[model samples]
Target: MIKIDDYAYTSGLKDVHPVEKVSFALIFLLFTIISKNIWVACFTFTVMSIGVLFKAKIPFIAYLKLLFVPFVFLMTSLVAILFSIAPIYQEDLEVLWMAEIGLWQIYISSYSIQQSYELATTILASVSCLYFLVLSTPLNQFIWVFKKVKLPAVFVELMGITYRFIFVLLEKMNEIYIAQSSRLGYQNYRSWFSSVAQLIVSLFVKSMSSAKELQIAIDSRGGDEHLYDVDLSMGYNRGHFVIIFFSFITLFMIYIMTKS
Candidate 1:
């Protein structure tokens, strides 16, 4: 099982109703995206982090590693927002630093710096909200929620199949990678590229074979058109709902108080 999925099944919040968890996550995600207040973004990020690490009982190191994955990508993209290139430097521009390269000038302005900071916080905050959901709720529960909402059976089935396929591909890829590494397939840069190409091709072929086997199994089971029949009924804790409601109200109050 994937680390995140394992965490979800064993999470402290696993017993909480899927509806409650989904609503809480979506609400926080929407608020983080729509609110322009930096304080609100910071608060959301901190609160969600606490929920995931403390309430959900996810490992602190694991959480940091997950966050770090996106942090690298975020920093890479933020570079574009943090700096600008122009044919000539403007004397009146509020630049913190500048470099002259040939006839072009690359500069970091105070405004751009502020924008980058805000954008980074907002994105991280939104990601935290999503991570809370993913870390606490299993994919099966998510499908249950979708079905409860009367989502199309085809869509729900596709989601389940696609999620399963991802794990399958990952497992196959890992096995192939380990086998190759044992034979010193990645001893050099050239071999590494060749090994990666071989791995991709092997994964595609293996995935197709797995899909065919799955179809055969499904056909043997009655050839049902709808594969997912979720009968899960998770009871909601009123206390949790009350707590979340009051917590969000507190956040809104804080945002209003700090809006100036």
Candidate 2:
């Protein structure tokens, strides 16, 4: 099982209706994006963090590791936006700091840096909304909710197949790694590169074979026509409804404040 699914199934809120989780996450996500305020985004992240850790019971270390994935990209992108180059001092400007490299100059603008911070916070907050939802609800349940809304059968089927095959691909890659390592495939830097390249080629071939096998298995199980007919019983959680109600109210207030 995928690690994320593992957590989802074990989540404290896993038994709640997925629609509740979906709507709650989406509401905050849209609010965070539209508000365009760093404080609002930070507040959104905090609330989701509370839901994930206290409500969902996901480990803090795991959450940190997940945030690290996006933080790396955010920092790399921020470098470009926060810093600018100029030829000497063309005009009087309010810069946070400036550095002279011989005839050229590089400077960080206070206003631009402030904008970057808010943008990063907004993006990370929006991402966490989905992350919190995914962390609490299994993919099958999520897909079931989409089916409830009448999402196209072809697209839903593709999503299920793509998700199912990710583990298959990873398994194939692992087997190839073990085989190569046992035969001294990564004894040095030169061999390590060769081993990785070979692994990629082998994994590609195996993925094709895996897809074919999966299709045959699916056909044997009465095909994709009945895929969405699986039992996905959902029960309403009154507490979830109340939480979402207040969350929307709060977001509305924040939106008005930001506009003002």
lDDT of each: 0.89, 0.86
Q: Estimate, for each residue in 51-144, the C-alpha lDDT of model 2 and write its tens digit.
A: 9999999999998888889889999999898988888857776778999998878999987788899889998998789779989998888888
Give one digit per residue, the lDDT tens place, for model 1 in 1-260.
49999999999999889998888877777776776668888988998999999999999999999999889999999999999998774568787999999888999999999889889988899889989999999888998999989998889998999999999899999999999999999999999999999999999999899999998998998887678777776777898788779867876886788776
- TM-score, per-candidate, Cα-based: 0.92, 0.92
lDDT of 2: 0.86
- TM-score for predicted model 2 compared with the true structure: 0.92
Best by lDDT: 1
Q: How big is the RMSD of model 2? A: 2.0
Clashing pairs in 1: none
For model 1, the local distance difference test gives 0.89
**Per-residue lDDT of 106 in model 2:** 92
Return the number of clashes found in candidate 1.
0
